[model samples]
Target: MTVLKGARERWVRTGGTELCVAELGDPGRPVVVLVHGYPDSKEVWSEVAVRLADRFHVVLYDVRGHGRSSAPRPLRGGFTLEKLTDDFLAVVDAVSPDRPVHLVGHDWGSVQSWEFVTVERTKGRIASFTSMSGPSLDHFGHWINKRLTRPTPRRVGQLLGQGAKSWYVYLLHTPALPELAWRGPLGKRWPAILRRVEDVPGDGYPTSSLPSDAANGAWLYRDNVRTRLRRPRPDAHAHVPVQLITPLGDKFLSERLYDELEQWVPRLTRRTLSAKHWVPRTRPDRIASWITEFVTAVEVTGEPEPRATGRHAERFGGQLVLVTGAGSGIGRATAFAFAEAGARVIAVDRDPESAASTAGTARLIGAPEAWAETVDVSDEREMEKLAAKVHAEYGVLDVLVNNAGVGLSGSFFDTTSDDWRRVLDVNLWGVIHGCRLFGGRMAERGQGGHIVNTASAAAFQPSRVLPAYSTSKAAVLMLSACLRAELAGQGIGVTAICPGLVNTNITATATFVGVDAAEERRRQKRATRAYGLRNYPPEKVADAILRAVARNEAVVPVTPEARGAHALSRFAPRALRALARLQPPV
Candidate 1:
């Protein structure tokens, strides 16, 4: 656990706009960028960042006009995604230039993360990403997933909520009124205005003791959201592996909103927390542990070959377990879990530190052996090397878990060609590599091995929202089933884990349009809260995988909701389709 020691805080200028910057941990280590929700400042992540400083270089910033950052007179809708992305990238330039950064976002920040995950070029620029309570813009586009109960009351409340939460925008469209309000009428009514939109936890914040009886961060909401909503979704994003965290207790967004998040980044991993919308602040330790586990896992997948047995009939004690993107998230968790299960873990990841940490942790946990190594799951040569290395060391793989993946969450239009290709690379092609390289050997040797591929409940639930991601997961599910059919004859078991929400970091790795990472997260949080969602534990899913392997089951739905979705997908396809649409936008 990270103790609440001292953390560095600063107000810095990137462009013309200024931002509140809070940094902790060794600057040389990987940077974890933290973005807060609306009406909150960088201060919200203060205690959390200090704790995270123990393992990583944590960076938290208040969006322009929020927190301690200055609000230039007549603040431009400068909070837009492009501007915000630039601000984030600029932070990277200012702080950690040589190394890629890791991102952690909640609410509006998730939206920006959505954009971050879609571009191929940007893929090399980031190590990993996590989103909490954010929706993909293309998925969240104005399709209106609302169900208003009371006609008159609902209508009035909706209008006022929109206006109150977003008053600064209309104020910005015609800056004069906002200026007057900030200087006059609005100042007096700020209390009621702030209360209408942003929630201040009773136990948190000293603002409750202030006479003003309101928050100053509303400007962030008005300026950022109003601007993002106006622009068309961005055409592409830097394709980086992503993790999304959906809080089941969030009252702002619905679970259904994530029905097709994979369509956004195809290589997505979904994790839903049992907590409310305030994950970064409220559950920072858990969040940090999850990321640390994930990044460490990614690093461990790249280890060197251990000492080999001279000549054994079957060296099951040290078998090869090739896991893609093994440096982080489920892959990391799965890798660690497998090592603990008595298999020599071959942790594969693009990041060296993450891979190393994963292997290190697994070894520390008393795993007989663990190896961390880097390899692009999509690369034929890389995967082939993985196969050859395993073949030479252990002679045969007892288990192969294709758990490495990425998240795509933007709309079809917002995603670029690069986005599509990257999704195929890690999500589809990565699996293709694993199956072709690992499965072929298992078939040739006439020995059985369990292959478990991670897919989302979205696989069975058709989603056009995140077209690319959904399509890829669907392909994975299909491929897994098909491979199961062929390999079962050889006594090989293939299982597809269709998890609903397991409360991981996939949201941070999502890509969407228009909004920067922060704004996107806000919308996602809002939409999740508006609807009800349920999340499960990754350990439970891991247990399911182990059971599936032992039983040679075809499919494993990790959550109760997932089990229901799985049944509906087969027995009542129409009802499943209908239910999927009920979710808020991605």
Candidate 2:
């Protein structure tokens, strides 16, 4: 069965091979040609092609000896990089005769595309190139030569590391052994191996032709790898704009291999993902989104440049970040921080005007896209609806900040049951709702993401006067810990950010339970004034949130007092408990 539904299929004859090509979306639109790696076919890109079909003409073609494509006779000298380039050119000419096509490749496909984009023959035919999980053999050759010529401890270590990773390459090079193994037991267990090792979803992939495909694909390495690396072209610089997406967890390639990539590609945009090698199946949404953004930018400006220029720009750029309570204070500051880092911001708040205002500011702060969402997190239905909308419209959230909350101040005895419920509903349940709805989606996407729960120093320090508030934040801190443990295997990170005495509007809005209306106003004024005197800015907490997500930290204390209290709570609990018994200034 064909993996790509509703795709138009055709054949392109190129240099003693007939390539099986599949086309999706409107042919009149800009063409995006996807080339699959070895031991796979056009079907490897089925998921990504479907996603990209909406915006561009999506094309997937089997390489000369894989899938439905006919293998060349005498496989020993058939699958050279030059032959692959010819096959690529043939497909492009057949599918898009007049327009330059946007090129995307993975694994061995990316290896050949490096040749296509660099060589003078296919320069004008290619518009832009996006490479993932693959490197140019020419570049690899030069990198290996450099380390051999001037061996240092670090360089030698890198070479040894890469050499170890290339163990599979050595196996593939053994004559007739790869073909026998692949066509027999290895083929039967290949799909299971991919599922167990790469976490690739089992969804009608590996096609039934996998055994023959793998056997025929052995010639790819034998024909090209040794010859090209030993005598790499000196002028193998890329002539087109390039976007490189590196999978940090790929076992086959080292991140250091591309350290000198900038010398070959004049215009380069780099993106890294926390994933294994098979991103086409596991991270189709992110891959499609990045491809769309790069293609659109190149189409409009005729160049590829970074959209953001802030700290951690490469990590957060083109990612989606959602911040609750984003109208003001820590929520707003955190949104701006992610915006400056080039994330697409979703500013959500209880107040529509505040959310919209934050979104507007986020756009000005360098967010490629900003949207306002109004929802009360305390209401489960509202949060559920918001999560569905975000998933359906904006794609899975890369980062979620459950920052919306309320404060209730008073002794436990003086605080009414209703008051306790109200505070718990917003402060504790709000975070639970966000985690349940959005966090579930992140896990389901399988691309990994982060969650930042806004707690307080009161969680650990404790105060007699702020009983309800302290309990709610303490629950948040513990909840984050539990989630971090549970989701670690799935690549989701959870962090509880505790801030102390930040100068924000939460102080003025805090309800004074057990006080008269006039007394409540007076208490609010006093609390706000005291916090202002302390003068800790919310932006610092925002910074901590970003850093925590990047580092995948478990629990972060934002302010000086918060850090000290956390330290004390860990080592000197008796002092904290005794301090909790004292009367508060508020």
Candidate 3:
């Protein structure tokens, strides 16, 4: 029985081996062939294949000697690149006989697919290629040669860095050790090790065939590595459009490996994920999305559109980012920032029209896709429903910004219990709800994500005049800190953004306690004018939010005053308290 439910299985005999192949999706749709890496089988692509099965004809085949496939007679020289290419050709010929297939590969699968896409025999057979966690051995050979021949300080350092990363490769080539380890203790412990180190979820992965698969797969390194590195093919240039996805946290590979990749593939698109290796299992949603997008573009326009060149495009492109209170001010600006970086924006606001406007503007700003969601963050049921809807439709969020907030101004004595509840509900509980709902999904996905909570300088600077607002923001700040510590182990980052007096419409909407309607309006106008004079745009705060996520910063103070107040609160509490005690100009 096949491990993938609903999959149609077949066997293709090639190079004296029977390759176990699984096909999913409609047969008439565009064909997408996913190839697995060493010591792994077709099951690695199960998560990704199922996601892509909706729009494309998805196919996954175990490389010879892995999964249910038959092992070569002699382990030595049985898994050469030439034979692997033959296996791929046979599979495609049998499954996608009428048309060329789009190829996606990870790890050693990518290494071999590089050979398939570049070799003259497979030129017209492959329509496009997407590679992750592996570099073409020919390209890798040139990279090594260039650094060795040049011998510059920077080049030497890069060579050493990559050499250190390839420590496992050396072990794989050792005669009997690898096979013994895999058959005895190594294969048994690999699943656990992956869960502990890579945060890869345990869900029927590393199938029972792992011990024999790993032991037999050792011949792949023996047959290819040394010979290719010593004498790489000079004509190793891709014949099809290529998409490269680099995992920033991949322990086994260096990003610098693809520096001169454009020379090998004329048409290229580059994307980076803040993930480790084995993304097929850990980040199936993201992988499926990119693959679908690339394949569709190629099928429609004959080539992918020029990719976004915005700052952090590599990091944010195709990622899903959700921002609450995105109708205006800091929330809207934050949504636009992620859009500019090529993320898919989910603009959530209480006002339906406002949310729609933000989503539309986000699309104009370069988001591949933008959506509007209307929900009152203060309403627990509404937030829960929105969370479920988002997960059902859009998959897990890559970034969540809990920027919805309300402003309140009053002394402790003047502030009503209702006033404090209103402020806390939006400012503090809103963040809590977003973290609990969306952040829980991110944790369960086991792929790391970031959460940004909008706090304020008032959080640390105690102000008698702004008791309700300050207390709410202070609670948010502490909550973010505590959550940061709690989720750090899960690879989730929590950031608190504190902006001082941003020139936005928050002031115009702020409520004033112990004041009549007319006086409240008057105070609101004065506060708006004061903030306008300060002229700290929410755009700057949005930029700070992005930077904080990139750097995984715990707390960020956006404005000069914010920074000053934050420093003073830490180093000179007495001075900060004195300033806070002074009567506000408003």
- Which whole-number lDDT from 0 to 100 does residue 343 have in model 3? 94
Backbone clashes, each candidate? 100, 0, 0
Compared with the true structure, what per-residue lDDT tens digits does model 1 show for residues 112-204? 666666544355567777777877554554312222323466554554554454344454455345445454665555445433333223233
Which 10-residue window in model 1 sums to the lowest lDDT? 307-316
Q: Using alpha carbons, what is the TM-score of model 3?
A: 0.95
Question: How many angstroms is residue 47 displaced in model 3 relative to the true structure, after the best TM-score fit?
Answer: 1.1
Q: Output the lDDT of residue 303, model 3.
A: 93
Q: What does the lDDT come to for candidate 3?
A: 0.93
Q: What tens-digit string does per-residue lDDT give for candidate 2 at 449-557?
A: 8999999999999888889999999999999999999998777899999998899999799899887999999999998999899999999999899888887899999
Error of 2 at 289 (Å): 1.3
Ranking the candidates on lDDT from highest down gives: 3, 2, 1
In terms of lDDT, the poorest run of 10 residues in model 2 is: 305-314
Give per-model TM-scores: 0.44, 0.94, 0.95
Candidate 3 residue lDDT tens string, 1-586? 3459999999999989999999999999999999998779999998999999999999999899999999899878899999999999999999999899999999999999999999999977999999999899999999999998889999999999999999999999888999999999999999999899887788989799999998998888899999999898899999999999999889999999999999999999999987889999888888999999999999998898777777878788989999999999999999999999999999999999999999999999899899999999999999999999999999899999999999998788898889888999999999999999999999988778999999999999898798889999999999999999999988899999999989989999999888899999999999999999999889999999988988789999989989999999999999988887888765
> What overall lDDT, based on C-alpha atoms, would model 2 receive against the true structure?
0.92
List lDDT for all candidates, in order. 0.65, 0.92, 0.93
Clashes in candidate 2: how many?
0
